[model samples]
Target: MPIPSRPRAAALAVSAALLSTSLAACGGDSKDDVDLPSQTLSWKDCPAPSESEGGGEPPSPLPGGTEWQCATMKAPLDWDDPKGDTIDIALIRAEASGAEDKRIGSLIFNFGGPGGSGVTTLPAFGTDYAKLRTRYDLVSFDPRGVGRSAGVECEDAEQLDKYFQQDSTPDDEAERQKLVDNVSAFNGNCEKHSGKVLPHVRTTDAARDMDLMRQVLGDDKLHYFGISYGTELGGVYAHLFPKKVGRAVFDGVVDPTEDPEQGSLGQAKGFQLALDNYAKDCTSQVEDCPVGDTPQDVKDKIAKLLRDLDEKPIPGIFPRDLTQTAATNGIAQSLYSKDFWEYLTEGLQQAYDGDGKVLMMLSDSMNGRNEDGQYSNIQAANVAINCADDKPRYTPQDVEEKLPEFRAASPLFGDYLAWGMLGCTDWAVGGAADHPDVSATGSAPILVVGNTGDPATPYEGARKMAQALGSGVGVELTYKGQGHGAYDSGNKCVSEAVNRYLLEGTVPKEGTVCS
Candidate 1:
């Protein structure tokens, strides 16, 4: 399955009042600050592991038998107190296969999750990045609180199963309390098991780590490719090291201007748009469309199915039954990419036939749960990073007041996504850190890619990011296609434009559109 870029929900925009202070704090280390150490990266053979070993399905053998090199770098656990303690950051590199004389510098990658492992994701893109790989060594790393690096592990598989089964859209006070209790319990567990690092996993901290990586790798400036949540990291990096920003591409851009409530509402509308597109395509293209003849009819059917599941969960292939939460997750996962629409059709058909195994499988895949009943730390890290970066200000009453607006934004997905903010209302370890607006003034041109039909991160967010980065520095490349990220979606025009930018340092003309 293609890794979906998880949305980084929190703020719409950074507080302008706090911007100057935070920028001063994060700006490239001053002469008085402690000089960062430079260490040689010892490249070693990449380990090849099976699906059960958290490697996902074994990637196809590298082209021309070119193997990846693995290494680890030390970074301060807390950026504020550099001498206190340190953690190892796992990194992988695939050296340029083209002529060294013509080779450009390393191209670092972050496949958004706030928690997704670049180690697992970058290699999978080897084929897609063939053009750029010839001129730049592709480097990817597990950010501070992500896979392979020190992670945030809140619950084991069993506990997580129960948590996922909880109803996100509560019907009454009792049910709402249950949702609150579950969120509180999850938050407490993260505080207990991952406390020391939870408060330090903010995007700014990870951006600092990236600067260290750039220095260690002997690059005068960083060339970055960040997707979805990764774009948040990239934006922060650009702001901190404006002079050092080199040929950065922020694909599926997240708008750093909206507050938490605005972000959620935007995402609600974005997902709704994607679902509407999917419904139209499904009804028109699929011979045996299971939903209905029209988009509204299709949505009605799905809404009814979710309501039915809420009333009585259906038994699945796994030991646990398919609850409304699981079914909703399954449906949302299918919205990430059109390639998965067929899977959604089949899963929905199976659900209507009283067998929820297919939908349950899709849900499990989204949650990073293996067939062996083990869960990855993706969710744990996702929550930890998001909560730490932007504190939730909405109370239960606040959400209630905004419920109508959320539902108006997305009738099918709004309630759950809005209420999802409840987890961070009282985060145990991390609070909202400064999320300064990113102008990246005086930086090299940065390309911002947006998919018109992207469900997560939404297309407008990309436009806003480009505008925020300053007219001269930020370039917006529009992909008038579906799915989340544009480069790897087999769109020749997008691929060519991005490749040209990365390889030749050529920015696409502003307002360039590729269909």
Candidate 2:
């Protein structure tokens, strides 16, 4: 699944991992031996906002009023040239609530953005992780090219607003060229503003930074919790340091085997399945069903609405009108979680009534566009990392060639997603398309969780990830539910199983399904 920093917007999902055969052995190799500094962290009060100020968001689950410690560490900007330039990585640590004797080592967290800010995500969701905080230090860091690190900055909010407002589903060649021109402008801005760091803001580089974190924290082995794109990081880390892997959990797994094109197609099919599920659920409702009773009817209605919006945009609260790209992103974001289905229903109803405010709100939330019209660096970092990790660059013609397969995979979302790949066609840095075979050979049992109806990362990819990790090493835990990431959302079975594994080193039996 393409794990966007925000709820997932603009049809872009970021993922990349290590290819086992391509990378050399971990230790003793010149490339592997970076003399990182060993420094003690001077703990200070974490800057977590109060519950009231946080809009009733629960305080961090850490004991003593949800306080945490923050610090920064230095790492080589380019792992290949360890002695070269350096960059700072931000970190947050909530000490174990339990007695010191009962505490386990640090449990690092990655919330899958190739661009998502761990600094923010951890504080917001740290309460759900209360079960683990008792026995382990809950820690997370913004990956390079992400928040608080050396972030990738592109256009300001005004420019980005115009960018998001552009038509993504082109009809004629002239319209297609407009799409290309917009992407080119965005890419050029990235190169102009952050080109120096863009090449190094890769998954492999982030994984290396993770190892540095482990070392500086004085942990002999690393214990990690990775979701979505973070799973790709964990997979790469396992391949890079199998011996250092300890009790890693990869939820909403990304298949390390697929190339960029294959990955995009797979995600297209996955999102289509999720849309189908939503349609079924919506049609069953006794009231407030915007679309007709049948799935095909619902699909046709939504498709026609999108087509209509493409022709005649709907004016909204914002200065700009609701374009097809924004509308599509708004619809796709709702598929990430079932909780948003009702809101989606409301938004679609409003759209039918010729009001675009609700859908525009959903679109803005998915894009990380705040009330002030400013955007988080999520989109910029997402593009940078995905393009840097995957080498495949498709031209407009190449995308046209693959349009049939993509459309067949997801008639509603395929065309936009297919065109999303073109953003990397003129990428400043060349990425390695083939991810290393991630057997995670010789590592401890790794937990892989999959949401059967997950729209972003499909259920089958999780099964494949487990199989690829080899015998006795990777175990799959199925959450037979909808949404992107499963643990602690609502499934007690999943939460407890993951808790047991992280706390007691207990691996769930194979084929364990949690509802």
Candidate 3:
């Protein structure tokens, strides 16, 4: 989350334009219990924030630009009861500048990780988005159970260490029992400690939080961008309030209908596909590629190595005890971006020779272990959010049935990922079943962006999401490159297209592909 950064403010003396409208007219609240009809229409250009009336402190001062005000929006903990207890989500907005620049509504940004905190990343990455920040207010927040604003804290770091170190993939009955016990302990501790807020941290709840923020910002509709898990949150918002969507973008789209087990299974297959691609690309360039012989041979080598590590983790090479499960998982994560593939390929080659430093680093990043021997809140929150959002389809029969398929998909990783999904069964929070298919039929057009080679959220998921949001436009930017999120990946075609869409009220023509 910290890798991306944000810039500071330049005073345009922008006026805060409050566009207040009635929900009754918008069909946002239908008390008669009748389904409201959604109608698509052209989006209207809205005025920017009034520089004079931005009457609070200037944006929080940052390293580069001047910081604006930190605003808090009241959102429902549970969407079902609008009148129920509300939680305050803290937001930071950086205003744009230049007289020639036309100010649009707020552009809310979310970097994935159902657990990823965006507020921290905004200031960190604002400088890169300076031009866009000049056009619209760049806004982000620490969602519930995240940083700054009320976050969920667990039993101390020591307890967390044990939780993460627990074996993910079980090869034997004893290992499986250990995995199950660790899962149960971790979840039980969550219930014992953060149980009150655990149930309210689902993706749908986050979407509702976005709407409340939209209203607070005085925007009639939502202008949003979400990555990875953020796409799932955006999709839910679009589905629940399609009429409220405004210039929305969902990258690394997650198919809401897919259950946890299926979702993880799909991810396993996706990683395998990426690995295959990496193998082909690397082998073809033997001079640059450390991976040897053929793609099949490389795959076999990795499988063999993982099997060896499973039995006895190599000593003194890594910070944590190296296990076949952790190594493969780390490798899978590296596949998310092609830039990281070189590192992984090299790591694989080294590990094949008994050196595990490179592989260990990959493992550390995926598992969120830091040099200080601490874990990033990402791992905890990722597990909590995924488990809480959807129930695993992992029964004895289910695992038995899928074991071979997973193994076939990932010789070294299949069974391990399967157990990771199974760990969700111990989650205390109930699961989400209702998929709020975001049609946003009547609202401003939404943009669904997909990277063809995104490993985490495959391109197909983005295509399906675009199809689901009939009122939305799908901008297929073929990166031919590999990365989890593409718009910010420096692809001229992709960024330019997105900038044009956001700045002008134009949606790329339907099924428009930017290669």
Candidate 4:
């Protein structure tokens, strides 16, 4: 199944009070008088595995042709003091099967979730990444506060259910206040329940851990492939240790310098762009399409439908029903991938018919719900990382500041998602780190790919991120295609270019466009 591309939930605009401190220090060290523990790790002598992993036992082999193994290391919670409390970093390695002595260094892979679990996903889907796996020892790990690696867990299933039950878009002051209170309570709960792991969950710490993994594998240079927020993490790594970068690829890049509010407003516009594409695709199939001739009319119809549903939810069959939030989420998610247009049209038709089951399913997927009606840990991690990364600078007065742009860009979703910054105002965690610029002046050339119609990460972000990196350049792969990440979804031109870059260390020219 295609992964849904929702907006980064917690990237609020930073406050002036939070930007006074510098963010240039690397290895997690701060310039303050009180030094924090140095967040570094070194590998010790250990027996090499009889062979790389694949085909077998209790630990289970990775599914692809590559071989796999496990490694663990210790990193300090704070990065200045070498003696501070330590956290364990869990990693999995998948080695190339060519001539044993000719193996290139390890290639690290991360699929963007400030919470996405690479360790879990790599084993099964590692095959799709065969080009890189065949040349380097492919490595994946659970960054701190994620999956198997001492991940932070939150509210019980029921409370979490209640949390999702609350509306993300508030129609009035009472509803807005409720959202603020719920987000604050959620943040408080994370601090109370995961304090031991909270402070260590920063992206800088995760980058440090990646460096340690590079050492454990005995690689002097690092080759990395990071997607989505993974691009953000990769950017941070490149900034801190530019010289250590190997063949790095960042697809669906996020521009680090963008203020959250401005960035999200841009994202709202990007989504609308993708939605317009979806509408065109939908019209091609006259039977299932529900949109009107012009994009404006289609958008207006959607707005009226949402308002109508909000006042009186559209009921489904025996076991399902659609709340305003679910319907909205479904429409939003479908806009991310043109491949989803058919399904989205069906969903819209059902919503129009007062049976919201299909739309509800899309919403469930957007929120990561399982068949058993359980939610994944993704939502918590999404909120935590984003909140910790930036602070909300919007005030009641500021609401009017960008309202016109937002409304014009996203008719149905503008006000609701643009105002999502309010959730961070009540966060107990306070502000974010000062620096947002992540460049790799000393690292090898990294490949950054962008799709023109990406809803989550705008194409312009790809251009901006490429500009930020000292040695990197952005490749505007014109995906006459639509989707969040376009790497493995079959555009031979794109896959071949990326594969050649990863397997042979060939950086395509600056303005390389793959259609």
**Model 2 per-residue lDDT tens digits across residues 143-190:** 899877888887887898988888777889999999898898888899
lDDT of 3 by residue, 371-390 (tens): 44555455556656665666
Stretch of 10 with least lDDT, candidate 4: 10-19
Q: What is the lDDT of every predicted structure here?
A: 0.77, 0.77, 0.62, 0.65
RMSD (CA, Å), each prediction: 6.6, 5.8, 8.9, 8.1
User: Candidate 1, after superposition: displacement of residue 428 in Å?
Assistant: 1.9
Q: How many steric overlaps are in each model, in order? A: 8, 5, 30, 12
Q: On residues 329-352, what C-alpha lDDT tens digit does candidate 1 reach at each position? A: 878777777767877888888888
Query: Which candidate has the highest TM-score of all?
Result: 1
Pairs clashing within candidate 2: 2-13, 18-436, 19-436, 20-436, 113-116
Distance from true location, Cα of 145 in model 1, Å: 0.7
* TM-score per candidate, chains pooled: 0.92, 0.91, 0.83, 0.84
Put down candidate 4 lDDT per residue, 91-164, tens digits, no spaces. Answer: 77666856767678788987765666565446546666766666787778767776555666667656865665
Candidate 4 regions exceeding 4 Å error are 1-71, 286-297, 316-320, 393-397, 471-480
After superposition, which runs of candidate 1 have C-alpha atoms over 4 Å from their true positions?
Answer: 1-33, 48-60, 286-288, 433-436
Q: Which ten residues in a row have the lowest lDDT in candidate 1?
A: 12-21
The C-alpha local distance difference test score for the whole of candidate 1 amounts to 0.77
Model 2 vs. true fold: TM: 0.91
Candidate 2 regions with alpha-carbon error over 4 angstroms:
1-31, 47-64
